[model samples]
Target chain A: MSQFLDISGLNARIDADGQEKEILRGVDLVIPPGEVHAIMGPNGSGKSTLSYVLAGREDYEVTSGSVSFQGKDLLEMEPEERAAAGLFLAFQSPVELPGVNNANFLRTAVNAVRRARGQEELDAVNFLKTVRAAAKELGMSPDMLKRNVNVGFSGGEKKRNEVLQMTLLQPSFAILDETDSGLDVDALRIVAEGVKRLRSPQFSALVITHHQRLLEYIVPDRIHVMAKGRIIHSGGPELAQQIDREGYTKFLAEAA
Target chain B: MSAPLAVTLEPFRKQLEGVSGQPQKTALEALHHTGLPDRRVEDWKYTSLRFLAGSVFHKPGKNYDSAKARAALAALGLAEGAVAELPRLVFVNGHFVADLSVTKGLFACSFYTADKAEPGSLVRSDREPLAALNTVLAENGVVISVPEGIDAGQVLLVSLGQADSDAVSYHPRHSVHVAKGGKLSLLSVQAGEGHYLHNPVTEVFVAAEAELRHVTLQAESDAAANLSTLYAQIEERGNYDSFVVGIGAALSRHEVHACLAESFAQVHINGVQRLAQTQHGDITSVITHAAPDCISRQTVRNVLDDRARGVFQGKVLVEQIAQKTDGYQMNQALLLSGQAEIDAKPQLEIYADDVKCSHGATVGALDDDQLFYMRSRGVPEGEARQILIDAFLEEVLELIGDETAREVCKTVIARRFPVSEEGA
Candidate 1:
């Protein structure tokens, strides 16, 4: 059977100033349908870069290899096309769009994705009704839908907003980039629950985080240890606790 | 003035002949002295009226196509919308068409002719060349006066310039007066077709305890040059709130001179300019706080695309006696193309000992992070850029108080710069 997401020999570099810095070096990873996976690594290990490359951020140049999502070349698609193809990324730092109403942005995004997926677009009234429910489920105030998108929102609120978007967009694959970094325990549970609620035989997620606390909430099916632009080791979900206790020094030394 | 400057003023100078009003003669003399300002003049430093050089702009004659005028009105939705119900003073070219106008009983409106033109005391024709030019050649205008303690709701002042083959010029002089405790909202729309010059001078007087909300939509033809000047004086506790949206004209400038003459008075000269494709738009204002405890606010935003260039020159002067004054000015520009340019000069001159004054200017392109965030959420790249552009302008557009005027400005702006294009 075809893999849900397959990244093999993927090498990506970013042009910083006058120098080219390789962020992803010959990395290979795979996630089958109906499973949640996590990547834990130290700083500068290119965890976030891997997620950005998957989401089709233009800043990174894919020097070699390929990312195939559902048997299609994902790297060839535009960012919006990837999004419409059921891929979502919960940014580590969600961008603030001032003067852009949250409700309007969500409606536009949801409608665009829906239209691309050959579904009917949601009108204003129906969209409001749908968004209000999703926002409520995420324990967010309805007023958040009226304010500017992520403008003046707390870190936890920004994280929840990402979950709200992920919920509304209904992506089959998602990448959570440190979504629980600044989130409180409640917010973490809520975020993890948001992911758990979408888990099915078709939906899969790659959670990039530093702590095992989030893994305790939505225990991943597998955990991968990434270091120096490559995933060096992989184990079962219990590997999260092992890494949390022993740290990545053991994994790095062993991989070396 | 150089010989070239004189050549530039020669067309207007010819029109000055056979005119005999004292104000007109004085304005003509001032124009001859200053000629038409060039890039050398400090006031006209960034703007050049060189487009008028050697171009004969005749006075708009009779027998203009009324059908075209009506069509322009229809384009503004004045023929059938909520704005259509408001009392509108329609000017085809520079001549007022009473048949096309509907004057109501809520406010007193009169048409003043050039033969009887009385330049108001608020404007300084000797110092400003455009005001002088307007004074010298102004043909006819509407005089609106709201009585004391009365609220005149809203009125529409529409100018439709339809120049077929000839490059015509129309100078319409308008004035507004609100008595103490009175209120009025004026929506001025400038739109038309073909190549022409629309120079209009408006004088406004806000009495003590009175309020006036004015909004101007300057959407002229792509080949036209619009040089409009406004002079307003606010008395004690009065408010002069105005917003100008510039989205048209090959070259255009909206200059405002507002004076807060008495204590507790307020004046706001807020505007936005969206230009594309070699168009040049300028918004220059000099606000004076002459009395203590007065307040002045100015915010101007510009969006330039292609090879368009935008200019913002704002000067806020607080006199020595205007202690305890409050003033704020912000000018921001968004350049969508590398070739597009914006020149912003925000000047604040305060002689007051105890005052709060702040001014800031920012020039930038669209935020790539914001664009990517929107696009990654499934919005097309073109639509994402459009949304960001709208958001950039949304902050200032919300300051417009009148719903009809605000909606009209939004409709016109969106019509000019669409929300999204297929490939844009």
Candidate 2:
């Protein structure tokens, strides 16, 4: 049987200025059920591309390879199907929808997933109660729910909002791409804890980040060092500090 | 048929043979001179009157199928709701239906049959061909007067057209007058079934310090053509606030001529059109700032799909003496399909240098990033698109100050365009 989440010989490319530029040369990674994996790499290393490819983003064309999630071919699913199958991607830069109410959007998304999973949808009263408790736990103001989705939100708030959505969506496999980059120490801790709360035997995640600060709060079961569109080395959770202090220079040399 | 009839004013003029009103006689003479406008006319550039060609629109008879009218009302959610409780003026086939109407309200209301109808003073029939057509063939109408210092709550003016095998057309002439210090809100709903033409002309006179909130919901039959014209004259400190929502018709155009005749008056002409299939919708307005300190604001939005076409033409003319006139106009369109089209023309003629006038337009499709973001969160592509569309129109709907009117428009739009069940 395939692993809980698996990627083998994955290659992807994007069209930039009418020219095809390969982003993911050959990415191979795996994570068993209930385990958290961290992929730390410098800029231009195709770290985010791996997350996008897994989320079924249409911009990137996967030339070769296979991705299996829970015994299903993940790449064959649409983005929404991926979501309904318990996959979520925390964007590096959250999009702003000017006139969509934050609370309403959250409810619609949550109910959409629930409906697909054959779960009874939550009504307005229950949804408001659940979302209110979630927001308060994230230290978010009530007014944020009334405003447009992510419009005019601060960087920290946008990140927290992403976490809010991740918490509400309750995805089985989440790919958080630099979700802690613009966050402060307190916000980073809250977001990490939000993810930690979802850690269980049924849950798995891939945390992609530049700094090791986030890993300190939500330490991973394994850490992989990626360079030039490939994961070159991996080890236990201790590898995060090694790469954090010494940087990817050693990994780049070793991969070369 | 003996030699296919030419598409001209001949059919319409033939009906005017025994028309006794002097205004009708004069309007017929004008029609003989100018004829119907084609695409060559600057105002009629984007819209075509060729839809009026083959079908000979006969004057609607007095009787109508009440069941069909009831079904139409049910479609609008007006059969039972807060809106149904309001005082209503019901007209079927252009003739007033007393049993179906409830006219007990705070205002003085009267009806005019085609022969006894007195054309209002506001229309310039010589210049506008449709207005001239309405003057000659208007069969039924409503005359509403709000007394001074009285706040008339709300009134419903409904026109439902039901045409059978023989295509029928009706021109309903309506006039609204608000005395000094009076306040009124008018919600006009136009709906119909089958092949027909609905051409209505309304004259509004707002006395000094009075207010008239007019909202029109044009949900015509898919096979019909709708041509409606409105004229409003606002005196000192008076307010003429109007909004038109167009979601139906094979071809439709809503034209408004508003004049701020005195200082400090305000006029707002805001509207939205949601068209699909091969539908065509147009909104054209001319606001004349005749006195200093008058304010004119207009915002129109269009959502088109399939091979639909949308048009917006707004002209703001500020007179030489109208200094400090604050005028703003904006038109935007969201094309949901590759074949959809939108034509926007914003004109500003300011003779006074001290006036402040601005106009802008934007056309675009739904942002892919926004769609992806929503889909990434488990919302299906179709539902995500619908959410974004509602968000796009929510900003404009919020501008409607009257709660009931806004709710009615929202209900109508939601019923007309529900969430798509299939994914993209």
In terms of docking quality, model 2 is high
> Which candidate has the top score in lDDT?
1
Q: What is the lDDT of residue A173 in candidate 1?
A: 97
lDDT by residue for model 2 (B275-391), tens: 999999999999999999999999998999899999999999999999999999999999999999999999999999898899999999999989999999999999999998998
Error of 1 at A37 (Å): 1.0
TM-score of 2: 0.97
Task: Evaluate model 2 with DockQ and give the value.
Answer: 0.90
CAPRI-style class, candidate 1 = high
Model 1: per-residue Cα lDDT over A185-232, one tens digit each: 999999988999999998999999999999999899999999999999
**lDDT for A74 (candidate 2):** 94
Cα lDDT tens digits for candidate 1, B338-389: 9999988888898989999999999999988898899899999989999999
Stretches > 4 Å off in candidate 1: B1-5, B422-424
Residue A57 in candidate 2, Cα distance off native in Å: 1.5
Q: State the weakest 10-residue window (summed lDDT) of model 2 chain B.
A: B1-10
